[model samples]
Target: MVNIQKLRFFDCNCSVGRVAYPHLSDIPDVEGLLKEMGRAGIEEAMVYHTVARYGHPPAGNALLTEAIKNNPRLHPVWVLLPHHTGEMPHPGRLLPEMEKHHVGAARLYPGANYHNFSLSEWCSGELLGALEEAHIPLIVDMDTVSWEDVYKILDNHKQLPVITATCTYRNNRYIYPLLEKYDNLFVELSRFMGAGTIEDMVERFGSHHLLFGTNMPQYTGTAAVSLLTYSAIDRTAKQAIAGENLGNLLKEAWK
Candidate 1:
């Protein structure tokens, strides 16, 4: 068996604060999050606040910055809202603050229904244009954005990069078409449990499109790492999924 404890991994998806799931115990705070990362050999993670996904964006984004600003290991992902309603800062104003706080990416929570404005599957030309210019990629989960909406967004902004989280084995049919069409679309392998799916994705698409993300605190951080470690792909591909792919993406997003 591979010594998973010794392998350094980077988790692209993580969250802090309270989740409504009553069954989860020992929810990690900032310090506890670091400890959990240490135990799992996770070198770093891109995290969002649990509040950000379902609560007010400005408040949640502020809290996320406060929680992770001093730590490089925990890169914060800001939650965004439609600018027309003035619920959140426009991308013009937000990108500067994001740079100041060292945030690497942004997310949208369409399902939270906190506001009446819609994401239009990210098809808002004004919003998508702003993000494309800012160079920050969009992150979403199945609960937040639907596949049909995501398709609409991609159709309009082919150059805009997006990473979808909480994706699972059953999403293959939809994922394949997106992967085939958009070079900028990425999928996290954390919850993907389709048997032999990872190897197949690697074979069909290059390793660059597959990223490592553990829906941590809900799922064990080691779960994705273990799944990748024991997969049939070569070591380079495994390492890419572990950290390299995300590292390159982050570097490019800010450039």
Candidate 2:
């Protein structure tokens, strides 16, 4: 058995600050978040702010930058929106700010509950096109958007690295086809709890596209860590899913 500690975990799905409905394990500050990461043996995390999701993107994105200013381990994943309404920056300006802040990844909340926006080519083509051009990794939750929309985004932006997180377990039907189709598409591994699911994915889709993510605050890292630790795959595959895959994605972004 490989020691869990040896796997350098880099969480792709995590958030900080108090939300409207706070989770029982929610950590509202960076100190507590860092401590939790240490407890779970997580070396780094791509974190966003609650305000960014539920509140305005500009203010929330700025708050995220300030909150995680000096912490290299806690990478900021800024919440972005359509540039049509002037609520957020256009691609030309947004890329520079991302570079300045050293943001590792970007996310979109194009749902009724959060930012109400369209993900179609006509609506988000400019922004999505820029992200693809820059090689920035875009993270989207499956619950927030329909599978059809996900397909459209992938089909349109072929080279854009997109990570789909927080999908329900029934997602195999919808997700499997996507994994098979899009080389730029990836899935976050926190919720794939079916026995031998990870092993099957590694065998079929290759381990490079499956990322390790702990839906922190709402969940703990222990289960996620164990999921990869005890998976019926080789050590090299486990390590790649744990952090290397995400690290490579971040490295490819225009820093």
Candidate 3:
């Protein structure tokens, strides 16, 4: 009954600006992003903060949260720094706040922000535990870490479903085994290389585990949208990648 082909998108890996590279840190504003999404057929997007690029995770998350609060089409995803500040925000405190404010997911940028790969005892146990208990999906920037490191983190927390992002064309091969190995791992097709790459990933991994994403300002939304529009896959699979997969995931998380 869900019209997968006509379904809009919920981009899982977008960021707002930070102070680091003022010019380069320019992510599109919510209105601008919504307009772009409309043109590209995206209905909503789950975005996070880019302030980590400037070493200010809390501020960045605050900006993102406020932006999404004002836009019905935008959903906020808080960014947490378990390694940078040497203090993890209390998940018991934070998860309720996110729920109170309508935030849907938590994102980690380990490679971009230089966080330790191991999710062992030293990591932010409280935060991770709360997310698992709350059943909120965690989005990780796979572009920031190696496949080996990603696997290790996934192994530590098998219950949490992680949506991986900032994926480039070259990492397609590395992503396959992980997709096959973990039922909870999903890949966002953001910076994916070409049409061929998208088709191959969907063919091998099926459409259920691939979500549509556009890094936006860093890359054109149109280009990322076109990659899927032009792919040879069935309309159902394309629909799943575009938004259905992310929607189903959110429905389960919010349930």
- CA lDDT of every candidate: 0.80, 0.88, 0.72
Instruction: Write candidate 2's Cα lDDT for 182-251 as tens digits.
Output: 9998899888787778888899988999999988866788889988998999999999999999999999
Local accuracy of candidate 3 as per-residue lDDT tens digits, 205-229: 7889888898765555777787788
For candidate 3, the lDDT comes to 0.72
State the lDDT of candidate 1 residue by residue for 133-244, as single tens digits.
Answer: 7668788787667898788777777777888888978999999999999998888988888999999999999788888888776667777878888999988888889988
Q: How well does each candidate superpose onto the true structure, as a TM-score?
A: 0.92, 0.96, 0.85
Looking at model 3, the pairs that clash are none
Give candidate 1 misplaced runs (Cα > 4 Å).
1-7, 112-116, 121-123
Of the candidates numbered 2 and 3, which has the greater lDDT value? 2
| Candidates in descending lDDT order | 2, 1, 3
Q: At residue 200, what lDDT does model 2 achieve?
A: 87
Backbone clashes, each candidate: 0, 0, 0
**Model 3 per-residue lDDT at 130:** 69
Higher-lDDT candidate of 1 and 2 = 2
Scored by Cα lDDT, where does model 1 land? 0.80
lDDT score at residue 191, model 1, on the 0-100 scale: 85
